[model samples]
Target: MAILTPGKPPRATSRSRSDARTRFSDRASAWLNHPMADIVLVLTASGLLLALGSIMVWSASTVFSYTQFSDAFYFMRRHLVFLGVALVAGWVTSRIPVDRLRGLGWLVFSVAGLLLALTFTPLGYGVGGNNNWLNLGGANSMLRVQPAEFAKLAIVVWGSAVLANKRRLLDQPKHLLVPFLPFSLLLIGLVVLQHDLGTAILLGGLVVAVLWCVGAPLRVLGTLAVLIAGALGTLVLANRSRVDRILGFLNPGSDLTGINHQPMQALYGLATGGWWGVGLGSSRQKWGSLAEAHTDYVLAIIGEELGLVGTLVVLLLFVILGYAGVRIALRSSTFFGRLVAAGVTSWIMMQALVNVMVVLGLLPVLGVPLPLVSYGGSALLANVMALGVLVACARDEPDAKAWLKRRATLRSKAPKRRFSAVLPGRS
Candidate 1:
């Protein structure tokens, strides 16, 4: 009867585990306290996207750029220049306070609105049937700038400020609808006049998202959305070409010789791409089979050469980008910063969605570039600049405490050198 039980191991208590966790967390925090985490990740992702985009741009545009300009790398070179400028601008912007950005929002909106108005004047240039570009005279005589691009960015800033200012009254439909409806419609009308139904629709969605996120009532948003949808439907019906596009989308196979040619060809390109793709630079579709193969229809070219896998990769990159953007927006401390980051992310991502959807026959073809991967000077620069804003917001986030500490250290050390010379230094 007298077998003695072996002594049992002591169980871990909540206090002991809590202490261990606290110690582990302290160590982790120490590591993270060296540089901004969100900023580094954002910058890294952005750089990856940009680098991949550049390579793909060259691949996408080599034939077209060569044929159109007699220079094999014209578009690529131009894109590089824009990339450099945007990077500088973004870095500078990151150093500035978000509060300052709030002040600039209204000014930016007003200035961009003016520029949009100027596009209707003689100074404007019509490109590919859309008169939405301004000709800034110089060595870049043909240098065209799309005011709508700036307007989108401005809308983010202005909308954030508007929402912040009216936080209390957001639930009141009258106050919310009265100011936003007219301001938003003015921009949409101007874009529609430019014959850019894509941008117009994109802007409309953006305004609605911003308004909703800021706490606009569901009924108010729903009613306005229906009205906007009806108005847009009427506008499309009024235009014969718009009707043709919608029809073409619905039945690409039926109108091969007429309105449905582009979408039909795009679909064919996708089919030929099969599973693994024909291999890079070997797309028969790019050989004049599909129009605008490097720009609006680049996804088709991707499918043609890179296959389903490559297409999926592109989609995955976008998904990752969207996730990162939303992460940054959520982490942002200030309302303006959060909205700005969210709006820019949504703007670029939505455009990418429209481009892919149109190419894949899921939506009506409205000419929109595929963000960074598409070949277009205006689109490329504008998009990079928008990404820059996202980077700035990420850099300022709370998790970036480590990175901010390093920056502070560097600032302190740098300033000591400046004052050393004034204190009767050896030099």
Candidate 2:
């Protein structure tokens, strides 16, 4: 309250207030411009989807579990276990350097190729008519692995790494086609050979998406697009089951009790839910009406149980995730990070859209599981890892570097020396 002497220091309270305000303003500006803002959005959206998946998986799988294993929580328990493993893997993967990942592109691609090739051996286990699952367990058959699911992540990481390396040389078709084209084609061919049309389609989509994001010449993208479409069409024609699904899609009135049973039942479940749904654990269709209710068609089960509201919430979460992913890609400074962010985002979003379209009868049943939401170990693990990579990109973004530098400086500052308690040369 009194006037300060001319040579005296300002009041301690006044100095503290001013310092606090300055610090607050600095932090506010930093947060507004920080790369972590986008990453927070990504993690928040992922957490929401994962939490929702846990609840829906439990609800949808209870009936199926009870009949098969005499325990309603069997699938739920297994899914939680997988979820734990995936989250940890994602965190660890996020800590790895993007440069290292870029360097391992070809190696990762080769391993994925090897796994796909192994599907043709005697150790291959065919499920749901697709010889795509690898049998890696003992004679008791305690473990099963899906190589196709892992292939999605591998293609995105490896493919984007290749494209990012040639970012400036992308005008040349040779640069675009060299390793990415050949390796991508081989992997897609292997997945199709295993009778998995859905994964093959996703792989094809992944190539186009990555190349396009990396600014590949239009001529190159167009040529690959046509070739991919032709290959898919040919594969569809060669497979009787896929042809039937296409026919069933074209003619909804055909054979409700035959090849179309699954799709029709899925539709029936959705229609029965109407607005608010039949209530959790009260779905009539899940008892015996709809098969694969816990996997590919879990969205339909959600519609039937939690109604249109729940389904919309799931859709909204995907949209939020996609938006955050795009933002992250845009904010990334490194070519490798930018390419990876786009590639992973496209694969996950495209797969989710495909699953939803199939559930809604807009597309043929491709047997693609809903990412992060459906109950599949390999798919969940791949998705979490992909998101982990996204987090890493966000962490290394231009602004993130600045933030980290500031933090390092703070930690490096030496505390003021206190010698009052020590006598000089006492020892």
Task: Candidate 1: count the clashes.
Answer: 6
Lowest lDDT 10-residue stretch of candidate 1: 415-424
Give one digit per residue, the lDDT tens place, for model 1 in 140-218: 5537788887778778877777666666776677777667668867877888888888888888998988876676778
Clashing pairs in 2: none
- After superposition on all CA atoms, how large is the RMSD of candidate 1? 7.2
Q: What TM-score quantifies how close candidate 2 is to the native fold?
A: 0.87
Off by over 4 Å in 1: 1-35, 138-142, 401-403, 410-427
List TM-score per model, in order.
Answer: 0.84, 0.87
Top candidate on TM-score is 2
Candidate 2, residues 1-427, lDDT tens digits: the string is 7688999986778878999999999997786566578788789889999998999899989999999989999999989989999999999989888888788888878888888888899878888999998889875343677889888888888888887787777777787678888888888888988888889899899988988898877887788889888888888899888899899899987998887888888998898898899998778777877888989999999899889998898999999899878988988888889989998899889999999999999998889999999999889998999999999888878887788788879888957677766678886
Tell me the alpha-carbon RMSD of every candidate.
7.2, 9.3
What is residue 77's positional error in candidate 1, in angstroms?
A: 2.2
